[model samples]
Target: MSSPPDPEDLTARARIRDAAMRHFGEHGFEKATIRGIAETAGVSSGLVRHHFGSKEALHAACDEYVLRTVRKLNEETWAAIKEGDLAKASATRRPSGRYHRYVARSLIDGGASELFDEMVGMSEAWFTGFVKGDGEPDVPVRDRAAVVTAWGLAIPILFEHLSRAFGVDLSTPEGDIRLASALLDIYSHPMMSPEEAAAARAGLERAARRSTTEGTST
Candidate 1:
């Protein structure tokens, strides 16, 4: 007869999974190793394999964990904004902020496309509701906006060098608040009036037409 699952086995597996996610986020999937993750988790390499079967499977679990964390963050952001408190809704680096750093690095390393897509999909669903006016932008515009938003959020973590140049340690709470305030200021203010925006678009269209005509003539 088969024996039942051990609670200790479950605990060890959870520890391994958490450690693998941290390693994958920090060093990336290619550079992270089963032995390294096992060491970080304080478990044996054999235990890791027994629990996850392979490094690829462990990476998959890490991806799912990232996705779930993102979804929870999204929900919390929405909740705070619904209460009319944007400041409260702003993304804070978590207590175990290593996960956040890992995510940022993973995106920069090009190993988190699935996470990016899931976020964009979630944003599209939320923003689609706001497109009710006569001048509502289409899917392509929304896609580009979402990508820009993702980059804006990722750049600070992805390129810590830039933060260093600015004399700000973004890993600290003070620096995070400084950056958040600046971003909030920009987002709250209109960059241009509608008339100014329309004029800018017209100028761009004219330039585009000229370029096309010049190409055709050549």
Candidate 2:
């Protein structure tokens, strides 16, 4: 009798939720404001509050949205991996690389940085778990390392693709892939002795200094 609670109102709420996600993704939780989101979504602040109750609730909703997206992407990747299609799996799973462009666009176009970071962090944790074999003790370390290396490689490549997709020349795709490969190599190595760890740290420090110096000169 109430006209199904107004489909238009439901659509407006969905728009507000999407706008809030973009704002939170771009600005982060501490900075994204309810009024700002309402304004961006072309809704009154009171209506936004009426729908979400509070900023915290809105943020929780944004997190939920991001998690759902990541889950969908992961499922796609898993399907590809199960079929022994590494290329397809990488294509599906490399959120940071390919998906970042959409995220950046969302931030630039819709102002959703906080949601983007949440998604990034969630994806990183997922990949970390994949690398660690989800607590399966019987899973061989070598196999885990291989998967981790592949993940690392995939991230940078995907990022490169995303950069291109978004029309941002932040870094070359090749560079990203190379950096990811190096990081994977480090992670795949056997656990170092304390002395070895200390030496590795010192070497890393030197490399960092060298990089800083080169950056300054350039």
Candidate 3:
């Protein structure tokens, strides 16, 4: 009789998933070949096909794995926030800048661009649902918008920080966190008026223009 799958087999599978994730992150979906992944995982290419079926299935699994990690991190952050552990919450929050870098790199490295869009759409849907809660006990639209905005700003900042921790180039997490905190402070100011918002918009526009000019020149 054939032996049952051993713990070593499970560990090997997990290693394959990790190798796939790193390869995909570095080279992207389209360019990340199954043979390369198998090589990285120290397994036969045939084994990879046997486990994941196809490149598309492997891509889906990778996306699902990343999203799952993000969701778990977010949950941990929320729990810390609820428990009034600000430091722990900050540490546990998903790094937004890192995520943005990952997406940008994936696009540049010929990764599956469609997968990126799908991930973002999924995130938006999840965020909307979380903000809306039960429609039966409807929240004020303004309050919901505020919550959504806060979350939107926070997530990217967390990604930035994680990217730095992981040694990825692009914006540092500390910088993103500082910027996000400033924005949050401005938004939460007791005396924040329309004038302040207008000024902030103007400043943001100037920054964008400067960045565009620099990019063009380079």
Predicted model with the maximum TM-score: 1
| C-alpha TM-scores of all predictions | 0.75, 0.45, 0.53
Q: After superposition, how far is residue 214 of candidate 3 from its true place, in Å?
A: 35
lDDT of 1 by residue, 1-218 (tens): 11233354368777898888788877888999999999999999999999889999988877877676677667766676667775666542332244666777677777778877887777776666432334665337567658756866565365477567658776666666676677768766778888898899899999999999999999
Mind giving the per-residue lDDT tens digits that candidate 3 earns over 100-151?
5444455555664454444455445445554333234234445545555445
Candidate 2, residues 1-218, lDDT tens digits: the string is 00122254368777887788667655766788999999999999999999899998986676565556666666677667567775565455444343343354444444444654544554555555554532344344455445554453344336566556556543545444444355557867757776796798789999999999999999
Pick the winner on TM-score between candidates 1 and 2. Answer: 1
TM-score of 2: 0.45
User: Which segments of candidate 1 are over 4 A away from where they belong?
Assistant: 1-10, 91-96, 129-135, 138-141, 162-168, 193-196, 211-218
**Displacement of the residue 158 alpha carbon in candidate 3, Å:** 12
Show where candidate 2 strays beyond 4 Å. 1-10, 94-218
Whole-model Cα lDDT per candidate? 0.71, 0.61, 0.61
Candidate 1 to truth, TM: 0.75
| Backbone clash count, each prediction separately | 0, 15, 13
Weakest ten-residue segment in model 3 by summed lDDT: 130-139
The RMSD (Cα, Å) of candidate 2 is 11.8
